[model samples]
Target chain A: MEDVYMGIDVGSISTKGVIITKENKILSSEYIWTEGNPIGAVKKLVRLLEKQFDKENYRIVATGTTGSARKLVGTVLSATVVKNEITAHAVGTTTFHPDVRTILEIGGQDSKIILVENGVAVDYAMNTLCAAGTGAFLSSQSARLGIPVEDMGEIAVKSQHPTQIAARCTVFAESDLVHKIQVGHTKEDIVAGLCQAVVGNYLNNVGKGKKIQSPVVFQGGVSKNIGVVKAFENQLGCPIIVDPDGHLMGAIGAAILARRNKERRVFNFDVEDMEFITREINCGGCPNNCEIICVYRNGEMIDSWGNRCERGDVAARKAANPNAAAV
Target chain B: MDEIRMPKAEYNHHEMVVGIPRSLLYFRYGVLWERFFQELGVKTITSAPTNLKIMTNGSRRAASEMCLAMKIYMGHVESLIGKCDYILVPRILDFGLRRVMCVNFEALPDVVSNIFFESPIRVLSYNIDVSKKLDERRAMVEMAVSMGFSHGKSNKAYKKARKAQNEADSRAVKQNEAKYKNDGITLVLAGHSYILEDEYIGKPIMQYLNENGVNVVRADLVDRKAALRESERLSPTLKWELSREIVGSLVMHVHDFDGVVLLSVYPCALDSMVNDMMLRKNRITHVPILQMTLDAQTGTAGVETRLESFLDILKMRKEVEAGNGREAEA
Candidate 1:
């Protein structure tokens, strides 16, 4: 059987999975909302991908996971590699666009700018202390405007004139948008302005003081928005490449990484049916009171993390799996 | 302004236990303080390493706008309450005009005294403002005398403490210098000693870097006069002493390390300006820099992600430099 690889990107808002052949060709792919339950979401996501996967023709040899919930999903899938979304995105983008110099990623709760040179990422910055210019921000503002977030891109591109909305902070932006709406600005113009604000906020915050060169790839959930794409293109005077599979780049990158790994572990699709429960245990052994996350498979603790000291480590392990050996 | 009252107990000063909060200046002058007190035959009790309970209590007592380090300092002060006879709170203004510390240091004694005014807290304090002609030795000797030690004894203790501090500092600098000989990816950790050595805030990052096979060099380990002089090459107008040392160390040894990680606590005024300048003026050096601003939040997820990505970048670049770029994919 041909060797295949599986990759999963479990983010806060969405979960994406993809199965790829040895040559990095996509064999199957699936995307679903996480809905705050990463364990349940990954199980659903794997099942969806399994349905599309050609089990007889391809055998998954290695697996990888990425995004915010990468560790959680990686544990559930027994992934060979668990990597950050930045590295995943950079690797994924550079694989498709070898000369790409920059990656603009606006996820559900965070935004980042990665600068690449010679097929390697050189510099990067993530949004600090705020979630102002992200996909969640756009969707929430779209809700306030009584329009679906999916329609924002089309409506934004229709505006001849865009209103100015302060995008420094969400609180200020929301109040500014309210005032503009009351002042009788067109809905399309306001929507277009919001798109511009997202770009402005991104450039000012995440892309601050960095050199943005050509061959830029904009991925993540917000890349689907043509309005923001237009704004970025207009501001930077450079064409932004939005791959059709842009949202799955993290997953695709993960799969690519899995394919590159020397270790081999055949992935089982039946792992999706396993009952995985994530429980938060406050290890009160010390004043640190570290909240440890213990993942259990049908009440047997499989993995744990988040303890700062060895005392908490021992306490959490004992508390999480009472029947298991002390070691 | 009301005159601050010092608690007057008839007990001998040598028998009185002094509480040193493990925050801020403690990380800088802890060895000196401890050694001096020991020489004076006085007992000292240091507060425990920072924890979640101390952090929460500190947050509740601190002003909303205070930086995370200062808030943690407040928590440390609170932890020492009712535990010792007198809490040592040093007011460090500046070594010189251009070497000034953040205003928080100058205001520490007042802040601690005012915050714990009703808690029966007696503050044992010292002032060091070199521009005002009150040097460290003078300040330290005066403080010991005020604690009822003889002038001769205080002078001897201060001298011994200064000698001990110098040796400790030089040892650290030598250890840092030895890292340059290692044939691996070395990164300079540029931050204040307090933030870089704190148990809750900076220890985890250091541990992670060590576990990842990265050689860590501290920017504060270099000679003070040499670092301050080197800093003038980067920014002549740079004032903060700690910031100057970090910049000087980074500039002096930029070519020695593979990369630099500038760690700063959230909302730090000095670091905000200094780090921004460093990033903008980094055109002189061709090294990758990653800035991580930490807060009181317990989650290390975001920090871990950034660190992992940073290491990946460094490793990939190294591979490409070695002409093995094709094999380093992903």
Candidate 2:
């Protein structure tokens, strides 16, 4: 059987998975909407990948996970490694584009800009407190514009003049968008302006101060928008490299990381049958009342966290142990 | 009904209660201020650590564009309103020429008073304007005199408070300096003492950094006079007192640390300038720098992920330096 590595990235808006051979050749991949259910989303993603997999030729040797729900999904899949989006994205993009100096990622809920030097991440900043210039914001605005979100990029590029929208906050931008629409501006102009506003907001907030050197790669769902890509190129005064599989970079990076730490172990796919549940309980062991979370597989406990004292460990052990009463 | 015994005084000082809002200046002067009041036979009370409700009240009172730290300070003041006979909010002006504070510090007293015009609670204020010759010591004495204390008592209390404040600062400096000798990786965190020391907003990052087993050092712990002098190398004209001191310490001590984290509260005009200056001016080699800005939302998960990624970078950098370059690609 050919040795292959698998990676899964369960994000806030979407979940993606990728399987690659030992030589880093893509075997199969899947991307699905999380729909607020990361667990279900991953299961669906895996099930789709399984249908596409040449099961007889390739055997999954190692698995890794990334994204915000990485820990949960990693534990469920018994992934060899679980990493954050920044590291995963960096590794994935740098592997494909070795000379890339910067990575600008705007996902469904957040935006980030990473500055790389000599293939090493030197500095990075992420948007905090607001989702002003993310994929979700663009999609919501598109829905209000009486156009499909996917069609925005095509419509946006048709305009010769793009209206200016406030990039400081989403509330003001939305109101300005309405005002622009009421003033009988062309739909194409408004669409193009929205893309420009996203780019402006990103540079002002996430890309503030830090020097953005080029050979840049833009990734995540927003990179799929041609209008936004055009706006970024125009604003940055440099063309951005967006790979066709940019949306799957996070998962691919996880796969590469898994391959880097190739471990010899069988992935228990049957464990999917076991019921996975997480429970949060306050440990009254001390005055702090640390909220302890226990992840259970079927009726037994697999892991627990948020315990400040030995009491939490004791509770976990008792739950995991068959003879001891469930705490 | 108080359990502690009271010291002998010419006049009864039991009714005197000084409320300190645990905001901007409180983090820097709370120990000395409380110690002074205690020595004067006056009781002292401070507002609770920041929470959502208090933050909301502060947001309601402040203009949206104001810095997060100032808004949080306003919230602290609001929390103490109607709860204390007098709330202490100092008007910290310039330390000296070209050494000015952010405009918020200079206007804090007026803002609070104007916002709470109908409130019965009196604001106990002390002006610290070294540029105008009304220094901190003089202001404190004047405040004590206005509070109806005798000259002799106020002098003695001020001296004692000064000594106490000095001792407290030295002890902290010594404790932090001790981390320099640790065998593990050390990272210098440059940020406001209030933001780095606050229980509600700052504690999580502090706890996270400490638990990672890396030796942590704070720029605030460095000697202020020496730091101010050290900062001249980076930018002679850059003169925000605490920021200058922090930059100076970073410049002086960046060699001893493996990395630097520039932490700031979002929308800070002062930090925005200083943070950029550090990125452009600091001539350190190979040490990775991360600029983090905290907002109202608890972006703890994202911050933690970034911190972990930073630790990974540090680990990888160390490995490469140690001749294990094979892992660099991995």
Candidate 3:
């Protein structure tokens, strides 16, 4: 049977899954909202992919997970590789566009800029302590403007002149947006202005000090917005390449990582029915009060972490399995 | 009859325990203080390392605009309340002109006192304002004298403590020098000692790097005299004492490190300006730089991602130079 790989990206806003062959060809893909429930989201995502995947023609040999909740989802899927989103995104993007020198990503609550040299990420930075110039910022503004986030991109591109708004912070942006609306700026212009603000904030914050070379690729959830894409293009004075599968790049990268990993394990869609429960406990064994997270599979303790000392480890294990002998 | 023979009650110096907050200048002078007290036959207690409860208490007590370091310091001070006889809060204004510390250091004692004015916690302090010709040894001696120690005894204890502190510092500097001989990816972690040594903020980053097989070098662990000289030559106008030391270390060891990680706490004006200047003035062509500004809300995941990607970049670069760039994918 042909060897295949599975990858899942469980992010704060969305869950994505993909099946790919050794040659990096996508056999099947699925994307859905996480809706604050990562386990349920992955189960739904995997089931969707299972329907599209050709099980008879290919055998899934490896699996990988990426994004914020990668560890939780990795355990759920028994992934062979659990990589961070930055490395995953870089690998995924470089695989497709080997010559790409810059990768700009704007996701739900975060944004990052990665500078690539010869297909390797040399330097990078992420938006710190603020969600000012991310997809979440746009969605919130979209709500205030009585316009859907998906529609804002279309409306933005139609503006003749985009009004300037303070993009230093979300609070400042919100007040400036309200002031502009009170002064009667057109909806399209305001929407376009918001997109510009995001680009400006991103550059001033995450993209600060980094050299932005040519062959730039923009991805993540925000890449779907044409308005922001145009804003990036205008600001950087270079053509921004947005792949059709840009949003799935994280999951695709994960799949590539699984393919590259030396370890091999048979991955099956049967995980859709496995009961995965995550329990967070404030371990009081020490003053650190580490919030240990334990993942239980079918009422059996699978894995646990976040304890600083052996006392915490024992406490977590004891909390999960009281009947088991103490270590 | 045996109890009746124990007629004379001797005065115990160990009863007056001085509580030292494990933050700010403690990282700089902790050994000195501990050794001084030990030499004087007095007992001392240091507040525990930064933890969730301490950080939360500090953030609640400090002003909204204060840097995270300051807030955490306040929390450490709060943790020592009622735990010891007196809490030590030193007003370290400056070592000398152009070697001045952050203004927060000058106000730390007063800030702690004012924040806990209603509480029954009494603050014990020493002044290190060199502009007024006051020095650390003299201040420490006077503090000890006020605590009922003889002038000569306090002076001798201070000298011994200073010597002990110097030896410990030299050991650290030597350890850093020895790490340079190791054949691996050496990254210079540049930050204030308070930020780098804190158990809550910096330890995990160091732990992660150590686990990943990277040779970690601390920028602040260099010889202060050498570092100061390098700092003066690099940036004559640079004023802050700690910033000068950091700049000097970075300048002196720039060639040895494969990469530099500029770690700073959130909203620290000194670090913000110093780091920006360093980034702009950095002339090294090959060394990759990563700036991580952490705050109360910073999670380990974000930091891990950055660090992992950084290691990848270094590995990929090394592979490319060796004509085996393909192995970077593994």
Highest TM-score among the candidates is held by which one?
1
lDDT of 3: 0.87
Candidate number that wins on lDDT, 1 or 3: 1
On TM-score, the stronger of 1 and 2 is 1
Error of 3 at A140 (Å): 0.9
Per-residue accuracy of model 3 over A147-234 as CA lDDT, tens digit each: 9888998999999999999888889999999999999999999999999999999998888777889999999999999999999999
The parts of candidate 3 lying over 4 Å away from their true place are A325-327, B1-15, B145-150, B283-286, B328-330
Off by over 4 Å in 1: A323-327, B5-11, B328-330
Candidate 2 structure quality by residue, lDDT tens digits, A1-327: 878889898999989999987667888998899999877787778878888988777788889999988888888788889998888888788778878888999999889897776676656777765788998889889989989988999999998999898866778888999999999999999999999999999998788766778898999999999999999999999989999999888999999888888465556456556678877776565434456777887866787776645887876665567376553
Give chain B TM-scores in order. Answer: 0.96, 0.92, 0.92
How do the predictions measure up, each by TM-score? 0.96, 0.86, 0.94
CA shift of B130, model 2, Å: 3.4
Best candidate, DockQ-wise?
1
Q: Write the per-residue lDDT of candidate 1 for residues A82-151, one digit (tens) a residue.
A: 9999889888888888999999999999899989888878778888856898998899999999999999
lDDT of 3 by residue, B131-150 (tens): 77879999888777766789
- Residue pairs with backbone atoms closer than 3 Å in model 1 (clashes): none
Candidate 1 on B1-330: residue-level lDDT in tens? 013425333447656888998988888789999999999998999999887888889989999899999898889888888888788888889998798989999988899888888886777788888977989999888787766778999999999998999898888889888887798888889999999999888999999999999988888888888889999999999999989988988878878988889899988999999988888787557578888899889999989998999898888877777877655433
TM-score of 3: 0.94
lDDT for B8 in candidate 1 is: 37
Q: Give the TM-score of candidate 2.
A: 0.86
Residue pairs clashing, model 2: none
